[model samples]
Structure formats: C-alpha cells, structure tokens
Target: MRAADRFSFNHATAKFWDQREAVEACARAGVGIGLWREPVQEMGLEASAKLVQDAGVAVTSLCRGGFFTDPTPAAIDDNRRAIDEAAALGAPALVLVSGGIPAGGTIDGAREGVQEALSVLAPYAGERGVTLAIEPLHPMFASDRCVVTTIGEALDLAAPFPAEQVGVVVDTYHIWWDPQVWQGIARAGREGRIASFQFADWVTPLPAGVLTGRGQLGDGCIDFKRYLAEVDAAGFTGPIEVELFNDALWARPGAEVLAETKAAFERVVS
Candidate 1:
C-alpha cells in the first residue's frame, strides 16, 4: 500500500467523536484508527473491542498507558491493565507518555522513575505481545507533561528492552523542532524501534497552556513530505496516524473535522 493508504485517524484529532462513529468513519475510508483509554473504557472494553472487530477496523495504537514518573504499584497495575486492553483490542502498540517531573522531584529523577517503571512493565507487555511505545512530547511539555522530549532520549530508554517490547513514538509535532530528528528516525529504523508514527503540524502563537494548539496538516510549517520521505527511507512501513489536538477542530462537528482532516492529509501527502 502507498504510505497515505496507511493513514489512520487518531481519535484525539477529533477529541469528541463518538467511538463507534469514529470506527465507522475509518472503516468507510478504508483506514485504521488510533484509540484512547477513556473512550475505550466508557464503551466497555469488550464492547469497544467488539465494535472495532465487527467493523473490521484496524487498531493502530492505543493512546496511552504510562504515567509512571512516580512508579507506584497502583500506577504499574493500571499500565498492566492498559496493556491487557491493547491486546484485547488487537492493538499492536500501547502509546506511553512517561509523565512529567514529579512534584518535589527533579527532571533527572523523573527520567529515572520512567526507566524503572518501564523495566518492570516492558517484560509484562512483551509477554502479552504489546509494544510499549514511548512518546516523546514536545519540549514545552517536558516540565509537566513528559520528561522524555527527544527521540534519542526515548530510544535510549527503549534500548534496555528488546525492540519488540519497547519502542518510540515518532510524532511530528513533538519532534519536528529537534535538529536531531532525522537522525533519530533513521536510528529508530535501524534499531527496529519505531512503534508508532504520528503527524501533527506545528503552528505559531501556541494557545494558552499550549496543549490544544496542534496545526492541521499543510496548515503550518512542518515539512510533512520530508518527514514521510525520511521515515520511508528508514523502512518505517506502518500506519501514519494524524493526531491533532486542536481547540478549533474540537469545537466543530466531528464529521466536519474528519472530512477536513482527510482532505488536508491528502493534500499534504499525496
């Protein structure tokens, strides 16, 4: 299939889309979907799994399972549940957001905590055939959202485990600004560590809190074509999920946003 043929709509792109409807839309488009935890739980895990299975919708990746900056027993248990959910949903990867610096803790300490948590969970995830995809959020999110902010750093964390057990998320919005991004992607490919590939353009004048300001494809300065080319060259033949966390898009109807997003994706990638 062509790279665009592997397009998967990330549920976060249309934050409010009904889960069943989103699966139907993806089915209609003949594409896959990247799901999130909350909606999956809301619909009941078995029901959600059934929804996607019955629709014949591929589950690209699950939106998150790691917040082990503190590495509490409860936190690790929750992540284990996430892994089980991913396996049940037939998702090959579980996106992990290695949470921010803990309160009264240093960034270094947080990083250490993430490693510790992963060391414990990676084996568990591997046994269930789930890859813990470590997502490196943008630098701006480092202080409070994710301590892992670069592909290289994420890879280092993943290195301790087998690539099948631990890998990294190559989200354009998160890594576009890193000068070492291309190198990182290449390295990820060579190491067999690309667990997920996500797309989100970077726009200027980021909104307050800077969480919901992701740009639609081709609406900003990200060179998506270059990203595609680079990842393709690196042997990353996988679904490219478009995940935009945009306030404006969320304000509109989910169908409208999906239509627009599909058009934008075609325009940029075609």
Candidate 2:
C-alpha cells in the first residue's frame, strides 16, 4: 500500500498540544494530517498555511465547517468563511458536523435546518473547489453534536447536489456499529460521494460529552482492514485519517502521540 493509503493523524488527537508542533511531528512520521479550525485561526492562517507547506505534509481535510442547523444568515456566512479557509490550506474536503437540535427544537426540525444550510453552502463550496464531507457522528451524539447519524442519511442529504460539491465522511469510530454499514459504503461508492475516510477505535463507557473519547487504532473493536477492503471494493480511494479525541492521548507529548499512533495504525492495517 502507498504511504498515503495508510493513516493520517487528526490534530484533534493532540488537541492539548501546540498546533505547529503537531504538524511537524506528523510530517516527520511520514503521515498526512487532518487540521482543526480554532488552532489554525489562533496561529494565524497565513502562518499556519506556511508551516504546513514547509513541512511538506498533505492536509487531508479541514476539521469542520457546518453547525448551521438554524440556517440563520450569520451561520451561513460562517460556513462560507470555512470553505474559503479549506481552500486556502489546499484541503480537498471540509468535514461538516451538522449542528445538533437547537434549543426547544425537535430533531426533525434540526434535520431541516441542516438541509437548508447545505443547499445554501453547497454551490459556494463547489465554486471554490472545496467538497463538503458530511460526517455522521455516533448515535450517542445525536442529541447535541450532529443530527445526521448514518451514512445512508448523509447520502440522502447529498443526493440532490453534484458529487464534487457534496459527499459523506466515513469514520469507523462513529459508524462501525451500524448494521447497514456495508450497504452505506456501497451506496457512497456508487454515487462517487466518499469524500473523506477517517479512523479511530470504539470503546465502551464513553466520556461525559462523548466528544473526546475516541480510541486509538487497534485499541478498541473497529475492524479497519475490513473497512479498507470494503471501501476499496467500492472504488473509493482516499486518505485514511485517524482522528482520536481521547483525553489521555491529548495529555501526552505531541511527538510521542504521533509516533505511537503511526505504529498502532500500521499494526492494525498492515
């Protein structure tokens, strides 16, 4: 397999560390990177862009861009800016975590909000050469993180748009438990809508918010090799990004974490 065919580390894995150091570590380890938005902004976009460029690391995707469940003008405006940022960093896809239920709102209402928001942003993202990858967070997060909870649902949302403009993110950590996973992957492949493929292990007794408990490769029950086979069979070829949100991992040194993560990914997928 190609080096890029293996795994890329998401900055959220080392959320507690410095952003520049994380990029450098990933490059040195010969792995690509998935960047987050706040750190990029805090370090200054121009500087962050230059740092990644200097390191010669491929950025697989930008961490986020969708939270517009309300579809307010302000929310749409923010996502537009996110698309521009993804383009600036040379990231091919922008991961969209459709916002959760608005206060005093029904989940059905939030779904509508996500659809409306995507309709508004899809064209802009397409014109800018950025694809929006809708990520289906785990069902545990359905209440407050992302309303889109399955690959099938995400594809349904993407059906009306051009494949280049809208797609779905398949993160094993989030969707591994779904019984319909294979069919979902096949559908995404048939539609040419698999924009980003991320990896992380799944463990029990999740953390409080359920946002930062992602396990490292091989540490949990996810069968990554199976996923690789399925995705490849579906004719979807893309970087496999490892996006762990573990608190323990975040507390360690960034370089150490990257080195360990690389080794774990290789062991599991080799």
TM-score, per-candidate, Cα-based: 0.98, 0.96
Once superposed on the true structure, which residue ranges of model 1 sit more than 4 Å away at CA? none
Candidate 2 residue lDDT tens string, 121-208: 9999999999999999888788888889999999999999999999999999989989999999999999999999988998776777
Best by TM-score: 1
Q: Rate the local accuracy (lDDT) of all candidates.
A: 0.93, 0.89
Off by over 4 Å in 2: 3-5, 207-209
Q: Which candidate is the best by lDDT?
A: 1
Q: Tell me model 2's lDDT, rounded to 2 decimals.
A: 0.89
What is the Cα root-mean-square deviation between model 2 and the actual structure?
Answer: 1.3
Looking at model 1, which ten-residue stretch has the lowest summed lDDT?
202-211
